[model samples]
Target: MMADNLMQSPENWTESQVSTWLRTLCVKEQYIKKLFEEEVNGLVLLTLDEDSLMTKIGMKFGPTHMIIQKRNELFNSKQNSQQNAKPTRSKKTKLQQKNNSKSLHCLASSEVPSGQVHARDKCASEESQTPQQPCILTSKENCKPRPFDQEGIDLIYVKHRVLQPESGAFDLISPCHEFKSFAIAAELDRTRLQAKFAKEVLKFATGCMNIRSNGTIHFGVMDSKEDTGYVHGEVVGIPVKDKDIYVDALDDIEKCFSTDKEHARHCVRPPRFIEVMDRESTAKNYVVEVDIVPSVYILKGKVHAVLLPNFNEAANKVQYEKKAILRRVGSKTEPVSDSDLSDFFQRVKERDAQREEAEKTLVLSTPFCQDLGRKLTMLITSGKKFIENDKWFIFITNKFKPDDLSNIEWLLNMKILSVFDFDPDSKISGLCSKYLEHHAANMHSLQSYSKSSDRSIKGFTEKLHLFEQTSWLFCNGRSGFKANETPCDEMTWIKTRMTLLMVYVSLICKHILPKGSLQVIFLLTSPVEKPLLHTFYGFFTEMQGHTDIICICESETNFQRWQSFAEEICGTETVNNFSVVGMKMSHINATMQMIQPVKACAKKHLPVFVKGTCLLETNREEHMASLEILTVAKKHLPVFVKGTCLLETNREEHMASLEILTVNHCDDTSKDFINEEKANIEQQFYRGGRVTWMNFWLAEHKYVGEVIERDAYQDVSKLLMDVLKFPL
Candidate 1:
């Protein structure tokens, strides 16, 4: 017989023929060589037992069992072929025999006898087999129609039937399968069907929702262990009779997830049920492919959770439902710890803050008004000139509406009186009056000016000199006034001098000096006391709406004090609009020369300043109340105040005894006192009193009737009223 024919009937094969068959089976080379060297032919292979293979051929159990399995398959095929050659007696019998033949062919092609072959071996055999001819197996009365199309059934076979090497089969849970985005379950628990299945679905769904991904669960697929100790999936499939029960159970399990009315539509999508055929079995068995799609409306900073039903003793009825939060860590779904949840909230808060900051920066970068830009340019040019000339100058621009003629008339009349002492007959005063009465009817006409004669300009300059001398006297505390303690008369006189100086500069610019836009430039040649500095700050603050102001300080101490005061009054955002430059008198010329080019370029763009909308009185009252409360809590606590409110108050004698540090004293002794006070305050707040006491006091005082009724110093009024009702 030919070798190929002999291979079909393995009992008739020679020793070399047996070796060829073993090679095709992919048995290890060493085992093949050993079997061949032993002179074992097909007859000997069929008779060989596991012990004989191990003892005689020195084969391992895996190879030994594989050889035995192949030997039995060949023997069975030979016996079946011998029986098929028998002649039939009748036509009816022949037809029945033909039907049996087709069924056998299908059984051999698709199904494997239980425990006879491994999944890998079956896969290899299928790959080598020719395309199957159409058979009448589907026409059998016992076979049920497949629920899904052939393509979907084939897909399930390709993904779930092909067991990954690293995955554990027949295990309760496998990380390797989860890592691939799918899990296998043999069947639902009979004892606690709904509760058990709901738990598994919630865990997987929560993990998928938290990580923003999708996954799948393959039910009715059995994972089995091989003789080689490797585990893999086997598609035994769910029986057709129990299919409805499993489908209904999955639907009920999906309802266990928690969802609000707002998020009901956006909750996790219902898992899709796809019925696939059991490729390894001929029985009408199906595997349900549960496709899990995570929630699409997941919100930032929110952690997803599921409500798992807790069952009673019999496991039939749910007693209650408990919330559980889970997140995916690699292939495993783990319960989130308290610390991790807190950290997640913190990260979300920080991200929100950063986003808001970025938005604010974008808003501030938008182009400002064109009119503002022009005014800013003029201010810069005038400021540069004043710095170069080392002179005090004030430029006033009309900001009043054209229809607001009454306020305009009052402002101009006040300016004339402060400058010329109400001498309406004076030439310059008469000129201002004439302009206000007729030419200043509208804002555009008010900007127009006629050049003043030399006599008027000279007179304005001499008056400026007198005002300059008076300012020096007030600043230096001369004329019998103590430093930083100016009398009301001296303060009024100093303000009058400031008004005269502004008028003098305005006249000079219209006639002889270079003309520019609204700006106030003050060159402080000597150190002014704190009260006088406050006066200057107030004056400039009032004019801020009409002009851009700059203060050049000859003393570094005065500049720092001015900046601190501006921030305290106007807040940091508004303070930035007012430029305060401190430089030594000797280096003033050089500094101005170096910055002139940069300043000239900067004039093209206007700087944006967001004014604080908060009222100053409310802020000051709050600050004062907080200070007093702290002082009362910690007796003998020294407090500092910018104004003389606490010093003048007789209502609280205890507050008067407290050392009041004034801002005017910048000497080392005052600095030491301030530092000591800061340390004492810090310690008192931290370790001296119970925080609950202060909190209760503030909360009780926040809505005091007197404070609500009062327009100014509401916080201070609230504190004083509540102090009487305070629980000592």
Candidate 2:
């Protein structure tokens, strides 16, 4: 009523006077918000530039462009209104006005110029002047607000091998970029954002997982060319076996993962002919499971995950319809409308109030929980980079969108608690405890957020932690989350879901190199392991021979199992000292125990190394070993008493390298048997390719120096690379 009365009286108020009055009441942030609404581009880069104090403060809508636009609208409107007011003024007044316009012009283009406001400073001050702060809040590790927990990773793969000069794989990926991940990112098209988001919600949020395997297009038949059509399809999983379940699964999977034929080879297969590929490719592939070891493996910035908030579709629909109506009349925040002028400030405030109250109960109660927020954050980061081999390495997560963090899957960060910069300068475990206790709105400590469809971070420890020991086979996407997804009729989603699994396993092989909690030593008896074994024997001898002992054995059982042709390749005497226990041979773990003593003895005098077959199914053997530890017996080997990890590898060079590693594992007190004088061990070569045995069965010895699987033993050649360095 007063505003209307004042407008009518206008006590002789002119347009110039009113415009000036309005300008006095304006704050920088409000003005910037207006500019935000006017800009077409989505991103706003608020950088510092020297020499220009004139940049209107607190408004960065799009790169530097929006700032310029806002400045023009701000001062120009004033100048135009002034020039038209009081027309009878002198020519001198007009000249003064023109000078003011010129001064404003100089300030407008002064980005980065000397004596001008630094671009960074200018943006800061403008933002400072505003009551509401814009969240340029980058997705920093510090800002993650939560840690991940121990849970829900099905297949883990790690690829620690450096790029071999000849591995044709370097060709399939982009060479210009140092090393982009196997996955590629596509820009979100305007129309596709909602669908893309919806799909993510269904797959990750709804617990309906679908991975793309193969994609094909089928055009109309030649005879029915009149009504030509094409069908685009992918592979999907619907934990259920029903027909309707298949259709539903296919739809949900298709809705989320778009198909790409190039990434198709990245999945894990049960068992097949390896005449083409080694098992490590599946093991060292891109990882996709959530677990303690897995936490330390997956590198950030791959297209590996999409977080889905547990939003109820029905509730969201209702809220969307009712929000404006509720806000229209005397609400705490005004002006929320059909216009795109969304209000995050008010929304966040309301959310905070509601979330705070809901969490008050848990925050005060849970005995085990300390800092829920920190635990959630730790869980995510830890799960991303699970430590393997106790290799004494560290992983540093990069801030989102920072160039330095791009494609940097693995890096050597100095191992100091300070580098992590956790508050109180303590280890991660300490910080996590505190954060989960006092900080989480819900004092629920971290369990696993990745495995659940609900927005929960608790109560699934028993089920989610089962990732390490169990393998759930998916038949069209129904791998069994609590509320399994509905399936689809079209088999289109199957290929995609399968493809996702392969990629997941590949990364697991590459990153998820779990520590053999119980280490052991292995003897290579296969003829094929001989050549590589010989090479390693020489390499190790050069460093410290007494540190390790090499063993090679020829078995009558092995010779009879192979066909005559395979037998021709097998020579008995080459693998001389290798040992074998009884035939409970069905158990790979029990067999590995025989080699554990060798490792234990080596560690005592110098260093010891564990051995596995060419198939290096040590991944599976890990479970076997765990079972042995629990069900069989627990032996307390000394700290130096490391055990063997029965790994599978076809490259003889790897065996030779392992021989060198065994020596590398030793110190002054340990004896080494893999050096130059005992070079006879280097003469060994590896053999075997059947499922009946690991990739390598024998390490045949040559009277001469070792002959390896050609070039696979490079890691052995450079003996110093694996050394663990202490931070100064």
Candidate 3:
């Protein structure tokens, strides 16, 4: 019986016989296990070719080819034996009866798995007993169980075949409304795995990471359109030969992310690829489902970004690298925009602030903080005095030609006085004459008086009193030159005005007003022609020591010229007690409001100037000098000073000190930085130690306050006045 069984055809062998034969062929245990799991009997085994062994049975090529070779050899031997002997009718009938009995016995055996009983019974039926019956392995009842469970299989079937556009399911495999965490692709690039398909994979994967969810990408299935204009997903499985390419593409994508140290968390585990059989097709067609896991190590206060290779379509290769931060919006993956990125950072900042608040408690009674409070209080007080009592002399030099009267009118019509809330009719005496001839009598008297011995200190004082009543002095070059006068005459007239102004300031500082008490501001709208550069240079050189001059130039050229003249007068690149700022005429009101009156006493110490958006100090001497100004400004003001003994230290200690000072300062109703109209500013500062820094903007007005050392304080009085006086 054993000899006869060994010589029997492979299709006639039972399940136990087939397993023994595969073992004799040295088939791997895993392959044998797959055969058992699929309930493969002699009939099913004979039907499987090399493609079925690899794709359907999930075996590698080497073992699959080996099994196919053995099966072919068995068929050849059986064919040769059949040709060599013609069976008689009596012998054939008896042989067929024995085979039929063995087939029925095999179907009734307990060793056959449950689902395979149907196939075994069909094989034993009388219809299959014909001598010329062909094997039918493509029958629906003979199909192997799918790798996915019932639920998974149902999902894939719906996605692959259903198209309900009104319910948000579309035929396209693109990002859509139906699926937020699922995507589908038909195939990969045949030539290279990582061309366009790799990018799509990465984008979908990262989009899933940002949305904080796992996602799926089904390859070998695509959205197909019917002639009726309806679209639905179709299971167009990858070709047998190209399946390896698609597998490699998925592997490459996994390797690309796993190797990246920065974004490796996005793929904590390698993607899972499962081969699924096509439900509607009888052919050995299959689709691949890739499962992606969400990122495991997302950082706080940062948006996760992934690096993707930039594919050059024209060159048909990857040319460079780019970074992307993607998030799923509905069904589409979108790169984060600049505004969204900014808002994310802002939220991060606020979150960090909240965390810090929860960690550390702020105390307001520290010595350093008390010192800051005292300084802040003094600044507020001295600032008010400076704005109210200090005398300001604004000298305007208009060098516009006679033909350019429009420029002069523009200057006169500027809201310069309005910036300070000064009424032109009362606070400012006059606009000053446009013509130098209008000031000819005063100029003649000034020239004669300067040369006369009778020009005593008392006489100069009276003259200055009259000049002080006229808070603003306008010098028009157009007026200085007559129609008959040449350009040279105009230059001479300017020089005269410049000289007279300097002499008048010198007299005032020398005898009448206290030295270093007056503030002088120069608004030079018109350019100082090159011809009069030297004369203007000499005038500035003499005026440099007596006053603190702030020159606001309306044009770049004028600013540069004024800056050059200032540098020349000081004999170095650094200019002291002088500042040159350039701006458009339209910004004059805003610029003037930023200009604080420089105290004459602190001129040597305050050598810092603001140029454009930069605040520059010459050296350590200037930095210390500014602190000294603050010290003096505080002393002159009537305010309660506390904690005078705190020692200056590093930033941490300084901040601790400021917290106490802010609390103390906030207690005083008269010295509150925030008023009822600006209550939000108070809340912003008091919430945390946010007011540690010196420079801040309140109600669109900039205020600068600094505490360099225990004894040295910045003159925030001047800055505070400038800030508080500005209209919100």
Candidate 4:
């Protein structure tokens, strides 16, 4: 009787009721999110299992996805009630088709082109007969959309954005209430865009887990509800496995939009959005097509990883040790600075402060500054750091100019491959196995920074160039883990580990970035938390451009603080204080080797580094490059040293984007030291074939850290008073 009177029916229900209902089921609410409405089919079948079996919970399906799909069916089915209402196409005359071909032939001779055809010739081919196909995939026959594949989903991915943090300031009416296309400006609202993004991320994540439970895989879509309105989210697969079996539709999008993208700053053509807004125009429609796929990162299984230059086969291990631990939320540990993390947030805070500053500074730049406001969107989208360096790990390299290689000593001895075109991990690994005689995870280091004119440093730098294309992923399947919970919820697997590590390292002043380094904050609530805001904003609040990147990202947009930091490091603008993660893995997808060496606590009286021998060599030409690579590695210096190191920065012009610097003070006085050094450097700088180091490292096994018997951490600090070593 209660179901009969109230109107939650699809035809009469509003967005508010739906959003409120969805909130109650999530947050470990016992059952996965579902919806219900029965009168239409008498029994609204909630396709719980892929078998299409129906189970009626109430007047409507209890799950939101089923409810939304039903809503879409009802609306779309009603809208297209009259399938017979078709329009015939205007046939092109044989003479016109022939004339078109003849004109192309005539034009090839560099003659004046044939007279212009009627503008009407550009009408959509649909003006003639057409068969039904997937909607929006193609622009049209007449549009001849420049081979633009209809990645309608690609439109959903927004580029990175600079978030602002201000309590009660710049806060919106909830993103769901205003969420809309961040890419399409004509119909976009800033506050709405951010809200929509938050809602969708949450929805997509929850829906993805739900779908996986039924033993069925899905590609791109889920459903959401918020204060502003309803949203059908873009869903893709999570990598529980290392294959692209699920989310294949996204693959289609990626195919159309080549993965390689540039910032296209100051381009003359209108934003691709302008063309999309003019979707009716054939010429513009051709320009508006794009893929709407999101980049997918999966956390599954125990993958192996190997280090370079040195190794400890038996000591190798991962940062985290269990899958249950990897997935556990709040079942783990606490963050070092929750109050500080929230209060010290920087992305949103800095953005807000900068926006205020920009508002104040606008008068200074006049026309130039005026143009900046519109570019807010552009900067957010394309302002990514140049990280095309392989993914999955931090890859340090010596970025030398094309002509400047080959004179270095290492280059002279090594028969290098095309430095730009080989896999550093594979080549390095193969070389190490065959020639270095060292197993994976057993890399050696030089005893001293400058045993011979710092030439070895230069050689190492040049060789890093050869490794520019190398790929790697970090972690011991036992130790490394990630998750998709809130940044504040450090209790989640990934967050807890990062938080603990950040705290542990930040405790020391030598650490690159200190704890609570951030001073801005932004918190996005799920529709379940704030249904009123989501119901009104609807799809606008569920966009991907506004989503955070540090957590689970279901879209292609790279909108996060880490991405922001990377962009600044890689941007064309001058960087006074260049900072980036220092790790050996980046790109190239190399398997992980255990980080076993530092796992167990060593004798307190003598740090293991004191016992390990240091192997040193010199190559004059690439010495500078080598120093720079070393600087990046310094970030993790204390790890092997129980988190301690003599810190310095690379000031050289050609730092290869990796922050490393070699100690400049060294004496290798062998005869024509200076002259021989320069000549030797010039001789083998190029074609270093750094990949051969895998073999070269075989004979190398050395380690360097202050002797543990003394308090080196404090001693290094006292020594720091003097001019620090050459920040190679």
lDDT of 3 by residue, 237-265 (tens): 44344545545554444444534544534
What TM-score would every model get versus the actual structure? 0.24, 0.17, 0.24, 0.19
Local error of candidate 1 at residue 661 (angstroms): 99
Model 3, which residues run further than 4 Å from truth?
A: 1-388, 394-396, 399-451, 463-468, 471-505, 530-547, 571-573, 591-728
How would the candidate models be sorted by lDDT, starting from the highest? 3, 1, 2, 4
Q: What do the candidate models score in CA lDDT, each in turn?
A: 0.41, 0.25, 0.41, 0.23
| Candidate 1 lDDT score relative to the true structure | 0.41
272-323 per-residue lDDT for model 4 (tens digits): 2211211111111111211111111121111111111111235542121121
Itemize residue pairs with steric clashes in candidate 1: none
Candidate that beats the other on lDDT, 3 or 4, i.e. the better one: 3
RMSD vs true structure, all candidates: 35.2, 28.7, 35.8, 30.9
Residue pairs clashing in model 3 are 171-231, 171-232, 364-660, 369-657, 369-661, 436-479, 605-625
Tell how far residue 487 is off in model 1, in angstroms: 99
